[model samples]
Target: MGPTEWTAREEVGVGPWSGEWPADDRYDPDLLAGGDRRNVMDAYRYWRREAIVADVDRRRHPFHVAIENFQHDHNIGTVVRTANAFAAAAVHIVGRRRWNRRGAMVTDRYQHLEHHPDVASLAKFATERGLSIVAVDNTPGAQPVETAVLPRECVLLFGQEGPGLSEEAQASASFVVSIAQFGTTRSINAGVAAGIVMHTWIRHHADLSSAW
Candidate 1:
């Protein structure tokens, strides 16, 4: 099949339904019955929860995604969705144990998520795995992401919107990379920023010759 073409099993509903559901209502019966209405790509429409997850897992990428959850950032959900879309190896939630998944629109099921008590623990995890940690922030000393050399395997770390990366996060990152911007705004949306970084990794590391 083509990259955008998928053999859908059936049509599912896309609205409210009966009975208890997953914690994040990821498995919307209505959507599952009529087909998922969320922004997921064609390959995953109306598939069973486990089936979608298994498929994503089969082609998972080597890079990991980490976002600082100090404020329980709502954007984290959107980041998860993007990670799932790009088939990231895993997502690391730092600082908090729980985060809002509404933005993910139930796509988290197809993404692997991990939690760390603090930045130190997260740093340790990356170190043990031999994966370098790259923080997304625009500081005086930060390297331009557009020109930086990204590793084939590494963790792209993001901080909460507004506050940006914490001292510990900066300390842990091997280097900080900043996305280029010409607008008056100091920074872009955290979720959107994550998407740019992830795509950059794909362009550099992933084999896209068979993508179509």
Candidate 2:
């Protein structure tokens, strides 16, 4: 017999709820009646926006992610997506309020986001919250992140692509850590670097049993 042709994959998300509707306030009536096509975990399929955020807030990790958006960096969205995946306490966008959300894939809706006008503002926020600022850059005297001890309650700060961290950003940081690279590329983009540092924190502090 000849080999069969491959079938098309099913579309993502569920098409309305079957049987009795859930009475919980967390479930959205619109999503329950209509289909839910939001990019979210299976557990949050029919959840209301606020409910989902509340749920995530309850179990979010202690570490935060911050990115300098001086030039409307495209990597901001990817950084947000990765931050959401790792369940960072929140994502702080410093320097620019607006960023390209295409890479975030709507994950920004579920992730907590804060804005700061400058590096100084971010530093104040970290100080008030008792969080250390660990800047990621390949600047001189920057320790290798792989061997460094990342603080449990700290913000992993990343600079915009190409320019790297601003002088102010680096100065405000409690310390700087660089990701080791074996390739010919001089540096990794902010998005990938954010993911690596966030995962490093997860490995050191997160309770793995809670992971899906």
Candidate 3:
């Protein structure tokens, strides 16, 4: 048998305004005239990038997300995407600055990002901001994330794909949390781990009524 074929789906987002245009300053005139095909929510359709970012900053969660980037890990983009989805305060990239953005699906434009030279720098930034550095890894002596008491305001740090947390990164963390796994896999994808950790924080600290 041949592989099943499916019809191509219609393009996402709305076309240009049909009648009178909104007079709001937040609306993007270019997007209004050229159509808004971006991946943003319906509420954000035709909104200017700056306006959307300003709106998000006003209500961003206290928690932040960080990842080690010494190896140019492709998962960084996915982490950014998940952070944006959770409305995290910011994403801190430790080590190398350049990273693949393809997986972010252009959400990086709406997300706040920071760059750090090393784990120590990231720790310092978190400390200055009164945010704890909570590392996510399955190393020994780590608490299970499912039952751990995550800080209400903290930087949830993750490491490279296979190597996990470096010695310096682990040492800088206030505590380490691990996701429980019944399967035999040694570890899950770094991006998937990030999503799980961020969602866990949301469940513990975020106001559910504000979710759209």
Compare the candidates by TM-score and give the number of the best one: 3
Question: Candidate 3 on 56-131: residue-level lDDT in tens?
Answer: 9999999999999999999999999999999999999999999999999999999999999999899889889899
Error of 1 at 28 (Å): 14
Model 3 CA deviation exceeding 4 Å by range: 1-9
Model 1 pairs whose backbones collide? 12-33, 12-34, 12-35, 13-30, 13-31, 13-33, 13-34, 14-30
Which structure is stronger by TM-score: 1 or 3? 3
Kindly list the per-residue Cα lDDT of model 2 for residues 80-193, writing each as its tens digit.
999999999999999989999999999999899999999999999999999999999998899999999999999999999999999999999999999999999999988999
The candidate maximizing lDDT is 3
Comparing 1 and 2 on lDDT, the stronger one: 2
lDDT of each: 0.83, 0.91, 0.92
Model 1 agreement with the true structure over 74-137: per-residue lDDT tens digits: 9999999899878899999998889998999887777889999999999999999999999999
- Which segments of candidate 2 are over 4 A away from where they belong? 1-10
